[model samples]
Structures are given as C-alpha cells and as structure tokens.
Target: MTLDFSVVTGAWQSLLLGTVGTLFLAFSGMALAMIIGVLGVVILRMQLRLPSLLVNAFIEIVRNTPFLVQIFFLFFALPLAGIRLNPTLTAILALGVNGGAYAIEIIRGGVESVPKGQTEAGLALGLHKHEVFRLIVLKPALRAIYPSLSSQFILLTLTTAICTSISAYELTSVGQRIEAETFRSFEVYFTLTGIYLVISLVTMWLLAAIGRRAFSYPQR
Candidate 1:
C-alpha cells in the first residue's frame, strides 16, 4: 500500500495548536508538581505525626494508582462532589498530582542524602530551620537530584498524551481528530510520533539549560 502524508498538511494549524496546548498543560502541571514536591518534603521533614502520615498516604495512593484512572476521577467524579473542572484544568491537576507523588519521594531522597552536618552548621550560624533548608540544604539537594527530576519531568511531558482520553486538548487528541477526518491512521500517528520526539528533545535541552543556570557553582 502506498503511503500518503498529504493529510497532515491540511491539519498543520490544528496540530500546531495541539502542540501548544500540550506544552501549556505539561509546564503548568510541572510547576504545580515542583511546589507539591518541595512542600511535601518540608512537611515530612517536620516530623509532625499527623501531617506526615497524611502526606505519606497521598504519595502512596497516587504512586500506586494508574494515571488514567486518576484523571478520570478528577474529570468525572469530582463533579459529583460539586467540584467541577474543565477538561484542561482536570488534566493539569491530575498530571500535577500524579507527578507530585513521585516527586515527593525523589526530592525526599535528595534531601536525605545531604549531610546532617550541613544542617547543624546552618543552625549554628543562627539560621532559622526554614532558612537552613532553603539556603543551605535545598540547593545542593536539588542539584544532586537534577538528573532524576529531569527524567521525571520528561516522562510527565509524554504522559500528557494520555490526557486526551479525558477529552483534554493536547497533541494526541488533535491527532485523533485528524485521523478521523482523513482516515489515515498510520500517517497521523507517524506524524504524532515525530512531533512528540521533537517536543521531548526540546524539553530535555531546555531542562539542561535550566539546570546549568540554577545549579552550576564555580569550583574553588
């Protein structure tokens, strides 16, 4: 059978829009995940029995469940509780919540890897506990875990494709529409694969740049 990619040409604008939508969801979700990760680590470190247990429970639930189910619940079930969210909002919230679960563990491991002496030293310098964590421990810990965090974010980006299952606007959803209109499943999917590869590569490059700017310190 002869292959024709002509169908994609007609839908280029839609595909571009979808790419933008995917990027918006991924980046917004990532921001929320980072916030959750940092806050969750801080709460866990506080050693408050109840808060720690709650945070741990949240992490366990998110990590153990499939993301598709999580998104479905947010999109379908939350409305029953009188909490309605548009598809876009639900997708972002789901991605953030799911990514945050893993982020909590990844960040906690990095925090634990820091030498206790550093925390003590910061305390000795009259730094508040919050100051000590923010100024002394957090930066180095994040630098050490940058690679792992970067990988997780990349995975999170690809996971946006699954958001389409909830009728959320994203690259995969656009591809589905194009495929329906053109009846060219192979061509549509092949194009999507290429687009996704480009997005992933670009994301990796951007993350590498951010890491260098944020974590690089001059060696003495």
Candidate 2:
C-alpha cells in the first residue's frame, strides 16, 4: 500500500497540542525530580547512619520497581485510598519520583568522584563541612555528571509517552487518537515516531548547550 501523508497532515493541530503536553509533563517532572534528587543526595551523604539507610531504602525501592507499576499505583490505587490526583498531576508525580531515584545515584556518583584531598584542603582552610560541600564539591560533581544527567533528562522526556497509558493525552495519545479516528495506523504511528525522535534530539541539544554554559568554569 502506498504511504499516505494525509493522516499526518490532517492531525497537525492535535499533534502540536500533544507535543506541548508531552514537553510540559517531561520538563515539569524533571524539575521536580531534580529538587527531590538534590535533597535526597544530601540526606544520603549525611554523617548519621539512619538518614543514609532511609535514603538508600527510598532509592532502592524506586529504582527496583518498574515506572509503569509506580504510575498505576499512584494514579489508580491512591484514589481508592482517598488520595485522588488528576491525570496530569499523577503523571508528573510518578515520573518525578521514578526519575529522582535514578538522579540520586547519578548525583551521588558525582559527589564521590570529588577528590578526598579537596575536602581536606577545604577543611584546612577552615571551611565548614556544609560550606566545602556547597562550594567545592557540588558544582564540580555536577560538572562530572553533566553528560549523564542530560542523557537521563532526555530519556525521561521520551518516557513521558507512558503517560498516555494513564490517559494523560500526551503525544502518543494524540497519535493513538488520530489512528482511531482515521483508521490510518501506519501513517499515524510513523509520524508519531518521527515527531518523538525530533523532539528528543532537540531536547538533547538544548540540554547540551545548557550544560556547556553552566559548567564552563569546571573545565578550566
């Protein structure tokens, strides 16, 4: 059968709307994840043993489970237990929690990569532990993990398609809707794949640029 561009062309507005939703969900989720990750990393690195154990348990649970199951539990099961989140909120929260676990590992690795000598040097200079971590460690650690972090964000963006499973009307959902309405499965899905690919590539480039600008001093 000859390929039809008509179905794709016809769904332009719907696709654009879906793209906006996808971007919103992905970036918002990443932002929330970043906040949780920073706090979790600090907690995990605490001198106290209990804090480390609690943080590790949180990371282990989130990293071990499938994100889809997590989303289902948050969206479906929570409501049954009286915590009713709307679809978009559920998607954001699920993605944030899942991504935050992964970010914790990345951020922790970055933290550990900083030289022991640097911490000692900072201490000798009379810098407090928190001051040393904030000024000497965190920025360099972020620089060390910059590539990994950017890649993770990109992956998170693509994973936002899973929101469609919970009926969040993201890009994938738009494609599904178009296919249902037009009965042009191949055309609709092919267009979707290309659209998502373009979106992901662009996001990667944007993140790379941001990392370059933000982490420039670390290279010196």
The candidate scoring highest on lDDT is: 1
Provide the lDDT at 34 for model 2.
89
The TM-scores of all predictions, comma-separated, are 0.97, 0.93
Candidate 1 lDDT, tens digit per residue, 179-204? 98889999999999999999999989
In the range 7-121, model 2's lDDT, one tens digit per residue, is 8897799899999999999999999998888999889788679988888898999989988889988998887899888899999999999989999999999999999999999
**RMSD of model 1, in Å?**
0.9
The 10 consecutive residues of candidate 2 with the worst lDDT sum are 211-220
What candidate 2 gets wrong by more than 4 Å, as runs, is: 218-220
RMSD of each: 0.9, 1.7
Q: In candidate 2, list every pair of residues with a backbone clash.
A: none
